[model samples]
Structure formats: C-alpha cells, structure tokens
Target chain A: MAFLQPLIFAIVTLTVFFLAFKKYRVIYANINLGKDEKIAGDSGTRFKNMMLLAFGQKKMFRNLTPAILHGFIYVAFLFTQIELIEIFIDGFTGIHRFFWYVLPLGGFYTALISFIEILSVLAFVGTIAFLARRNLLKVPRFHMDEMTGWPKLDGNLILFFELILLVGIFSMNTADMALADGKYGFAISGMLYPLIDGLGDTTLHIIERFGWWIHILMVFGFILYLPASKHLHIMLAFPNAYYGPLDGGANKGEIANMPRITEEIKLMMDPSAPMPEEDPNAEPERFGAKDVTDLSWKSLLDAYSCTECGRCSSACPANQTGKLLSPRKIMMDTRDRLEEKGAGLREHGADHDDGKSLFDYISTEELRACTTCNACVEECPVSINPVNIIMELRRYMILEESNSTEEWNLMFNNVETNGAVWKMPASDRTSWINELEAEAEAEDA
Target chain B: MSELMASGQEKEVEVLFWVGCAGSFDDRARRITKAFVKILHHCGVSFAILGQEEVCTGDPARRSGNEFLFQMQAITNIETLNAYGVKRIVTTCPHCFNTIKNEYPALGGTYEVIHHTTFLQGLINDGRLKLKDGGEFKGKKITYHDSCYLGRANGIYEAPRQLLELLDAELVEMKRCKSRGLCCGAGGAQMFKEEEEGKLRVNQERTKDIVESKASFVAAACPFCMTMMTDGIKEVEKQDEVQVMDLAEMVAKAQDLI
Candidate 1:
C-alpha cells in the first residue's frame, strides 16, 4: 500500500488533467462556433487592460468591502500554488516536504510556508464572509430571481471547497508539525502543534496522512468541477479582459456595423458601383443574432467569462425598475444555450439543431426592456456588454422578422418620409429659427 | 436667427448649429435651442444652420434597430454636410452630438462635433462668454441629470458639470451620477414607445433620485432627457417645486444672454 500510494496519486492527477482538458476543448470549440471578430489587433492596449482589470481586480474595488474580501481569496489562490507545487512533488515521489529537502535556503522554506499559512487563514475568513453574504445577509444582487437554484448552490459550493481545502492544509501542517516536533517552525501550524502533541507519533502520522489525502483529493475535485461551474471565471477572466471593448474613446457607444448590410446599402445607393458577384449556393447572411452562433466570439467569451456576480443586474436600470430584463440573466441564458447546442453538436455533427434558439431562453420582453444606457456594461466587474447582445436580437427581430412595436414603426416611417422621428415635415426643422427671431423683435418693441 | 445659412447661399461660418428634431419641433426643447443660439450670437461667434437641408440624424431609428433607415438618413445628412464643406458643428442635443460625432464617421461624415455644454465651456475658457456675478441662478440648488449619450456614451460628464459650476449655483449630485447615472427612459429609442411593463418606469426611478437630492432645479443636457425629466418631475408632483431646465437655458440665464 505504501508503493500503491504514489501510483494512485499519479493516476488521479492524470485523470483530472485528462477530464479537464476534454471539457476545455468543448468550450474552445463552442466559443469558435461564434462569428469571427477582430479582437486580435491592438495587443498593447489589450495587454494593459488585462493587467489592470484582471490581474489588478480594479473594477472589484468599486465596492470596498467585497473587494477586500475578494482580495483575500485572490491573494491566497496565487500563494497556494507555491505550496501545491511541493505537494505534487511529494505525492509523486512519496517524499514529504520535497521543497524543504531540495531548496538550498536555510530559513526560506519556513518563512514561505508561514506566509502561505497566514494567507490560508485569511482565505478561510473570506470564504465564511462570502457564505454569510449569500445565505444570511441575502444580498439583493446575490438573491436576485435568476440566482435561485444552481447558481446559488454553485456559489456556496465554491466557498465550501475553499473552506475545506484550507482546513485540510492546516490539518496536515499541524499534525506534521507535531510529528516532527515543530521542526519546520511554520507559524500557524507550529502554534497548533502544542494542543495535538499529547497524541502518539503513530496517531499523528495517521492524521497527517488523512489530511494530505483529503487536500490532494479536493484539488482534483476542484479541477473537475470548475468547467461546469460559473467559477470558471477564475480561468476565463484574463482572456475576457484582454478581448473586452478597448476603445474608451468618442466611439465607445458605436455599435458594430454589419459589413453585409453595408455592402447591400452601398450597392443600392449607387447603381454605378460594380455589382457584387453572387454565390447562388451561399446561405443568406443573418441580419443579427437569433442564436448564440450568430453572436461574435467575444460575446461568447463574455458568456463564458461571466461569474454570475449579478453586478450588471444590480446596476441595470431595467432590473432596478423591476423590469423583466436582468443583464446577468442574459449572460447566463447565453451560456446555457451555448452549452445545450454545443453538447449536441459535439456529440452529433455540426448540423445538429436543438430546434431552439437563444429566443427560447431569453424572452422578447427582456430584450425590449433594455435602455442601452451602458449601465450594465459599466457595472460589470468583467467587461460583458449585454447591450450588444440585446441589440443583435433586436436587429434580428426588426430586419429578419419585421417584428416591431407600432410606435417604432411609426417613428421609422417618419424618419423615412418626413426626415424626423415625428410626423413634422423637414421644412419645419428651421421653424424655430423664425420663432426666435420673432420673439427677439417683440422684445425690442 | 439671421445667422442661418440659407438654401444655395454660401457663407463661411465658424460652426454649423445642428438643431436636432426635438430642438426643432418640441416646444420645450426649442427653448434650449434658442438659448444656445442666443449664447452664440452674444459671443459674436459666426455660426450657421442647415435649415431645411438638415434632417433627423436617425438616432431614434438606429436605436430602435432600424439600421437601414438610420443609414439612409445618415448618408443623406452626410452628403449635405459634405456639400456645404461643414468642418465643425455644435448641437444642443446630446443624441445628435453622439450620433454625428461618434456614429457618422464610419458612414463617411466626419466633422468636429461639439455638445452645447462642451462648446459653452470652451467659450468661457476663451473669454468669449462671461457669467455675470450673482446672476439669475446665483446660489440656486441645481442637480444635473447625466444624459446617457453624453455622460456614459461619450464621457462628457465633467464638461456639463463644469458649465453648471460657472452658473454660481450650488451644484449637488444625485445618488447615481456620472458613469453610474440612471437612465431617463428615453434612450435606446424608448422615447417612441411606452416602457415595457415594469414595476416603475426608469425615469420615475431616476426622478426619485432627483427628488431625494432635494434640488430646486434639475439640469438636463439632452432633449430626450429634458422631456423625460420634465415628465418625471410632474409625475412625482414636484413640478411646482422643482423645474427641469437644459444646461443651455441655465447658462443663457446666468450669462444674461436671453
């Protein structure tokens, strides 16, 4: 069984990586299913944004308390990787404290472990605070209508995983400290060793082994669970931030232009321009997004990068005013539809259709309620433009389906014939000039 | 008003005054247009209007997902502006400012478009416009509502607030202002239709914030916002207590230009 332990460890590590990679491929394929968008240029600005937004967690600081708590978990996650490296080495070779043996530094190992120990304690506190926020405080954003079943559970599960992993690390360290008579001089675990010192060496050894097993097993579980979890944002946030809207300029409000529509309009407006060579077998270009595939790949990336934080929904005017539209729900629905279709396509062929589009998941009422004020886009801790998705669906409804409200139709008609949103003629546009002059003349009199 | 460039009559003006559809027709919004024009006139700034040659920029149409109509309107306006060799424009409406400044470039209309607030601020900077001491709005409580198009869409928050500061008014802020400001329910072409069934309208929610600020006057920058906030103030029964005035009107009063 002693020899079997290393064999089992290697097998488990390989299986987790294999499974996680398999799921990752599906996500990659699903994202590529979207229409191509040119987010590849401007690497300099994109890299800067990734650093500031993702690595720096700049947007999270919009609210102070959660930012600090999130900082605790984020910092711990980064430091935990140091200890994990040693754990992986020890598991494979069946030699405990592999780094302690290999590293040439005298007290460096103790100091590093002590720092990680302190961070783990803070991570524990952060996890508990987050759990309290979800369950006890029932923060309005966390308890929004869309966060009912799986989202709520997934959020709690993530925290619980963090909590349990912290417990496992401390348990192993404290027990190992007692067994080794506090040889490592690790701060938190060394302090805890005194209470457990009365136990015999064999008992301490058993406890240490048990703790080590659970910690390693949980690591594997976490990796397997992440792809299916909204917590995947941890991995996806960097890329999403890199590909987010970077033109913080006068054109930030401009929606993307459809090249097909541009070409068509250009041809119609100028008969002298050479006619486009038509391909009879080609499928007609979609006017706007009806299904997830019609959306740009960046939008699909946004769907995947969404952590279900509800920040967008919390700040959404439509949601604030109690409209059916919730930007968070829009992202969730996009991801849900993608998963449904992606899974089917992955199993069957690319031609596989679920007989359902994104409209099945997102209602027209929700789409119509959006103000396109960019409130949701601004509030998002990660850059997810729900307005872009809404506008695309709206474009589909208007251009492909010709479905629109009577008022919008009237406004369109007015713009077409009268050159205004109202029925007033274009000749009346400068009538105010006459009135201003008349009022000035009357005042002079 | 005589400064307007008449049909087929050419004059090299400093800038073109683009009176958007609301500023041209809506009775309330027309006053904003007048106030802005008065300021330009008082400053001895040479400006002209497209008059009947100008049409809607199709802001509402584009926002309502009618891209074809919007493009048609945009191309026609761009052609007309290009024909006149219009190099710079100043608009009282944020919608027109945003559409022409931001959206028109891709459609072949590229001109230096300035919002009235930014234009007025620039005038004050150049010593072209001066605010009288202890003017009509001196020491008045004024809260400026950030229009989505101007504030968030184009990052013009400080320019409007900066103009408000010159008024000698006690500038207060709503709970949501600047980048986080609430919508007045007229953006995204919602002005054309009734709000989709919600517990309350967006403008009503926004008006609640304005009332909470307890300001005597709410300054608006966009005609759509002007319409929404005015109706919101009336809906909350604060129409008598609080007034919704555009930045141009406030500035005009402060400068004694009207």
Candidate 2:
C-alpha cells in the first residue's frame, strides 16, 4: 500500500509539472517575437552575465542578508535531490535501508543525512526571515500598488508549504530511527526516535504513509501553483537572465527603418502601380506604437515574466526623487492590463472591442513622465526593459497623433532653421576663439 | 574659408570653444564662458572662436524624442566644421562634449571633443597652469555638483575636483555624488520641457543638499549645472547667500591671486 501511494504521487507530480512546462513554453515563444534586435557585446561578458545573474543570482544580492540565506536554500535544494530520490524509493518498498547498497560512504550516511537535515532547517529559517521582512518589517519601498496584481495569499501559502516539508522530513526520519532503535543514520531523527518508540508498528507505518502523501502533495501543489504566482520566476528567471541585454550597448539596437506611414497608405491605395507623392497627406499617419500589437514581443514577455519584487521601483531615480513613475508599477500595469484584456476576450470572444487597450488604460501624462533612463532595467531582477515600452508609446504619441511637447516642436524648428536648439543667427559662432591668440596661432600653424 | 588650414597639414586653428546654448543664452552662464575662454587664452592655447557657425548641438532635441531635428542640426554643424577645417574642439559644457563625442558619430560628424575640466587638468598636470591659494575664503564652504553627462555619463568627475583642490578650497561632498550622482533637472531636455509631476523639482532637491552643506559656493563643470542650480538657488530663496559658479570661473578667480 505504501509503495502504491508513492508511485501514484510521482505520476501526478510529473503530470502537473509537464503541463506547466508546456504553458510556459508557449508564453516564452510569444515573447521572443518582440526582441528588438540581437544584442552586441563580448561573448565572454554574456557568459559571465549568464553565470552570475542566472546561476549565481547576482541581482538578488542587492539585499545581502536574504541573498545569502536564499543562496544556501537554493544550493541545498539542488544537491538534496539524492535524499528525495532515496525517500521515494523507501516509500515504495517500505524498507528504510533499501539504498544501503548504493551508499558509497557506508558509515558516513548518518553524517550526510544529518547535514541535509541541518541545511533544511537553515532553509526554513531563511524563508521565515524573508516572510517577516516582507510582512512584519513592512519595507514600504518594496510595496507595490494594487494594479500590479500581486497574490494576496502568497506569503501564507509559501510559509505553510515550508512548514509541511519540514514536518514531513522530520516525521519520516523519526519513524525510521524508531524502527532501527537508533542504529541507522539521521542523527537529528535518532534523537527524536524515542518519542515515537511507544507507538505500535502499525501506527508508525500510518504516520509514515501520511507524511509521504502530504510531502508529495505539497511538492505537486507547488509545481501547479508556480505558473499562477510570482513564483514563476523559478522557471522564467533562467531564460530572462540568459537573454538579458549586453551592458554599455545601445539600450535598444538600431531603429528599424519602418516604412513611412505615407508609403503604407499609398501601397494600400494602389494595388498595381507604385505610388509616389512629393508631399504626402497633410496629416502624418500614426508613426509610433498605438496599441498592444505595436509593442514588441519582448515587451509582452516582460509583462508576463514580472516577479513583482519592486526592485525596479527601488532603483528608479524618478521614484526615489518622488516621481509618479515606478518601473515596477509599469510592469505590473502591463500584466494587469493583459489580464483584463484576457478576461474581456473570454467574455466577448476574439472580436470583442470593449475599448480596453493600452491607449485607453495608459495616459499621455503617464507616458511622457518616463525619462528613458535605464535605471528600471538595471534594477529589474528578471531583466524587463521598461524604457523600451515607454519609448514605443512615445513614438506612437509623436508620429501618429503629433501629440508631443511643444518645446520639442520648437526645438526641432530651431534646429531646422539655424542648426541648433537655440536658433542663434549664423554670423557670430566663432567670437570666443578670436580672443585666444595662441589657440588661433595653433590653428594657423 | 581662407582661415582654414590645408588638408594633410597639421592645422594651428584656434580652439573653437563651443559656448553652447545654455552658456550663450543665460546671462550668468555667459560670464562663466567668458571667464573660461579668458583663462584658456591666459594659459596660452591659441584658439579662434566659431561665433555664428556654431549652432545648437541638438542634444535637447535628441533627448526630447526629436531625433530627426537632432540629426539635421548635427549635419549642419558637421558641414560648418568642415568649412572651417576645424579638427579640435573644447567646451565647458558636458552636454556639448557628450553630444559631439558620442551622439554626433551616428549623424556622421566625428570630431575630437574635450571637456574644459580635462583640458584644464592637462594644463595643471603639465605645470602650464597655477593657482594661488586664497587661504580659504571666509564663510565659503564649497561642494561640487557632478553634472550627469560629465560624471556618470562620461566619467570626468575627478578632474573638476582636482582643479578645485589646486585652488586650496575645502571640497565638501553631497550625500550622493560622483558615480551615483543625482541628475540635475537639465538632462534629457528637462530644461526645455515643463517639469513633470514629482514631489520636488530634481534641481531644487539637488540644490537642497548644497544648502544643507551650508556651502557658500556650489562649484560645477557644466553650463547646464550652472544655469539649473542658479535658478534652483533662486527658487529656494538661497540665491542671496549661496552661489553657483563654473569650475573654470572659480579657477580663474584663484588665478588672479597667482
């Protein structure tokens, strides 16, 4: 019966993980379509960034204490898969010492098990610290606005899951140690073996079966919940870090020489002949991004992949200086807007036009408020480029609606007329150099 | 056009110091530009002025989402430089330096650009420049403002402070300075557009640190800093006591003692 339970649990867990993996793959494919261009940099730098950001979790180190604690948990979880496999095999056979043949360090198995138990304790403590920091400590700087759509029950669910895992680990080891009369490995469990010694073998077996079911269920639940929560970073972060833009390079690569609006309209008008106009329509067609389709696929990916960590908001100079702009909020808004649109699509079907797109949701003031500084991108743990979104919106505002700042219009005119922002007359540009005779002589020589 | 040097010959063209829009248009800033040029000449660099031939470098337009206009101006400026056969350019403005050196390449205008602080430091390093210690002016604690382009954007923070150090002035630092320096309200063409809604104007917030330092003078290396801080000082009503001066002007005053 014990063996049947674990085998069934394994099949269920694998099925759920496989389903989530498929869904995430589709989301990833849609996002890659939005990449502006291939980033240019030293290949070594890309490798280093991947190793540090993806593997090393470099960005998380911004919060030093939590970073270290989380690092221990991450490393321990990666290495402890051997323990998990052993537990699963033991569950199937109802024989705790079945893996003795595979134990290379026969006498040291107790020590290894003890070390894993200690690491699990450390991970539990670290998770508690993280929970306290987010909830009780209430770091206002990291708080997100409501529109960002953070899961409310996330903290409670994660904490409960950790507690369940700890209990499950301890109960299994304790039952095993009681059966062996402290002869087996698992020092911590050996200490607790006496407590469960008075219980009958049948009761001990029942406890072991219960622990196995709960632990397996928790793992499977976590896998299923991942795609629906900010915890999606567990899977998304690797690719996000790997494909991040190269540093010291153009924030966005070469601007695509998009066909002018006039040409597009002309093409539409004439099916056969090439249409040419000396001066196209008096009104310029929308040039910049006007809607969701206007956003590059990477932008849509950015929306879906946000962990809602608020690291971007923390790094934003504008946010620090008390601006309305929050890079985190921007990512959240994109995600929230998408969710709303998805709901609308489901309700009204694909052809539904409820007037709910980026145009109606994001205001001109909100768009213009962005300074196009890469602070948000620098701070984003998942490597979302909020600046690109703002730029695309600005392009829409400028080219299509001609709704840009009057100052820019005036500056453009000045440059066109007199070759500068100030529109200075073309006569007196060289007066300062006339005063420096040595400089004059250096020029003449 | 005859003022031009022949092609393939090393030209002794006067330093075509671009005063830039902020320097030439703002009154107090013009004083600093005049003083800066005067000091460069005093250091014996033969430089000719490109009076009307110099136009706006289109930095403001480019930054404000008007790249087309920026390109047009850049092209015109490049043509003017070609007409003058000018090879070397120096400016007190970090914006002009960044635009000319970094942005102009995209517009096919390539020229050697130097910020005045770096050029002045070169003069000091070579012993061509000297400053007479003023023995510390009374009621004057000076903190330097790191202009974004000169400091964070281009990494020219130390040269200006080095020049100040040579003047024997007390160099007080703001809470955030150098690589993590705060942006003056002038970058990204914030100078040209209406201030975006925020808790405080970025310039005013930065100027508060200058006030908090109780520094009599806020020394800066860029024309934008000079203009923005001066206006910011007035906005905060600290203009009567606290003053904003370019590093060159401060160096010029110290030079008078020498």
Candidate 2 lDDT, A91-153, residue by residue in tens = 555555555656556767777778877787788887788778777887765454532224546
lDDT of 2 by residue, B1-258 (tens): 223212212357546677787666655666677677667657776665556556788776656655455555666777777777777788888888888877666545677888899988988888878755563442357899887777655656788888777777778888767754666767766677777777887777788788888888899887777777888899989888888888888877777621
Q: How well is each residue in A141-199 modelled by candidate 1, as lDDT tens digits?
A: 99888998999899999999998899889989999999889999999999999999999
- In order of appearance, the predictions have TM-scores of 0.98, 0.80
DockQ scores of all models, one per candidate: 0.73, 0.27
Cα lDDT, model 1, residue A216: 84
Q: In terms of TM-score, how similar is model 1 to the real structure? A: 0.98
How many pairs collide in each candidate, listed in order? 0, 34
Best by lDDT: 1
Residue B168 of model 2 has an lDDT of 74
The CA-based lDDT of model 1 is what? Answer: 0.88
